[model samples]
Target: MPSISQLRKEEQALHALLFTQAQYKNYIPVKSDSLLQIAEAYYRTSSDSLHKAWTLFYLAQYYRDSDEKEKALSYFQQANIASRNIENNQFKFLLNLHWANLLSDEDAENKGIEKYQTANKYAILLKDTLKQIDLYGQWGWCCLLTGKYDCADSLFNMGLKLSTSSKMTYYNYLLNCLSLTARERKDYKRALELVNRSLSLAKDSTELYPLWNNKGEILLEMNQYDSAHFYLSKDTRDYDPYFKATHYLNWSIYEEKIKNLPKALEY
Candidate 1:
């Protein structure tokens, strides 16, 4: 059996590993496997309920990131059950937030919305303005997925109103959501305007890539082939896989717009 000190060290190491993975937005399969092993071991051996809850939470996040939905949901439920005796509102808020995010996919959006509302209550009790803003943004996205444009618009604007100069990233995210809402409404002009605003706030190429993709997609929708090609051609090799997929999908559409079926297929 690992000593308490050893368990603590392992838990801290897990936290650092998770933070690094999140910050870089890159997942190495080998590293993730190792992380899972450590988390599983810790969970089995640790006597501390809170630490066990955290371990289960990390396991849930790992499965979530890997798109193993059933495993993720099971671990989330276990984590929530473990956390029931703890007094960590912040952890609970994060737990529910992520749970909601995962559930927001496809058929479970209403359940996700309920979880987000629960998270919102915890956010209120914690009195964390930034967290509240983030919750509103995520909740808006859930609403958007559920085809509740009005609800999404209202939630996004609520976050926007709470944003400040120091919170430019969150502000930019809100603008992106608003742009999506505008696009959904077929208000291409407003969508373009909102995305342009987001672009102006971008500090680097990493930030600019997705915005460029967004602009390209909007222009494509507007039948502006030349403009769409211009934005879509910007290099996005550094983007993560999901964004890269979106970029290529948009590029394909641009090629099709010019009746270059071969080029579209190549993209």
Candidate 2:
């Protein structure tokens, strides 16, 4: 059997093939299944084990997005265990950070934070500035989600400053983080500016989806429901849950207002 790296290469090639044929979109599940088969086969034969972990991680994402939470959690945990066996501190830290993020358990969240911090420290030691920026952004969002506003603010500011100073365009992820923080702080104007700038430069699907979602959320909060709905409807599967939930909430609010507005006149 081929190793995990070989299987991963095949998956990448498959992705390339799919991109060349818009028709492959119809058979996405078949492609996913094939990818998983290769992953499983790789797991059975690979000795280093990290490749198997990586395979599970990729499959877990596929399942998660497909609304299979249990399977995602299972694979994510498997990836964490595999990560522990590796000698590379940086990769291990990266795996822990991701594994922690995928977990819904509170204990897992704490563990994830611990791993994230460790990864950040190691990344600094390696002078892997890009990964450092990414880790800060990830940890910032984790803190924000967990209601640690001060920690979130500190991490976001640190990452944003480093990204800006380094002129690393890939680090535009920090802009999104900044926009999120600003919005949470009720600085809608600043949030809008940061989000719009990112949207203007967003070239790929990964970048565009978040930018649109963020813009939609801000617009919704500003009572711009129509624009929010339009953007939210663009891609249902890819946008952030926070953004999607807010979009739905705003839509409901607007609908209720429309229904109840005329009746209020009687009072």
Candidate with the greatest TM-score versus the true structure: 1
TM-score for each candidate, following the candidate numbering: 0.83, 0.60
Work out how many backbone clashes candidate 1 has: 0
Which whole-number lDDT from 0 to 100 does residue 121 have in model 2? 70
Question: How far off is model 1, as Cα RMSD?
Answer: 3.9
Report lDDT per candidate. 0.81, 0.67
Q: List runs of model 2 lying over 4 Å from the truth.
A: 1-46, 50-53, 56-85, 104-107, 170-173, 187-248, 255-267
lDDT of 1 by residue, 1-267 (tens): 454345576665566445544643454442364655565576567667776787678778778777889999999999999999999998899999999999887468778888898899899899888888999998898888778999999999989988863464688878988999999989999999999999989888877777887788888999998888788887566446876787678778888888999999998
Kindly state the number of residue pairs that clash in model 2.
Answer: 0
lDDT of 2 by residue, 1-267 (tens): 444355565464444333323333354443354656555564746674766666665666566666777787787777767767666766565665665566523446666676677677778777887888887887788888876767887998888788878888655677777788788887899999988877777778778877887777787678777786687666454245776665556456555545654443432
**How does model 2 fare in lDDT?**
0.67
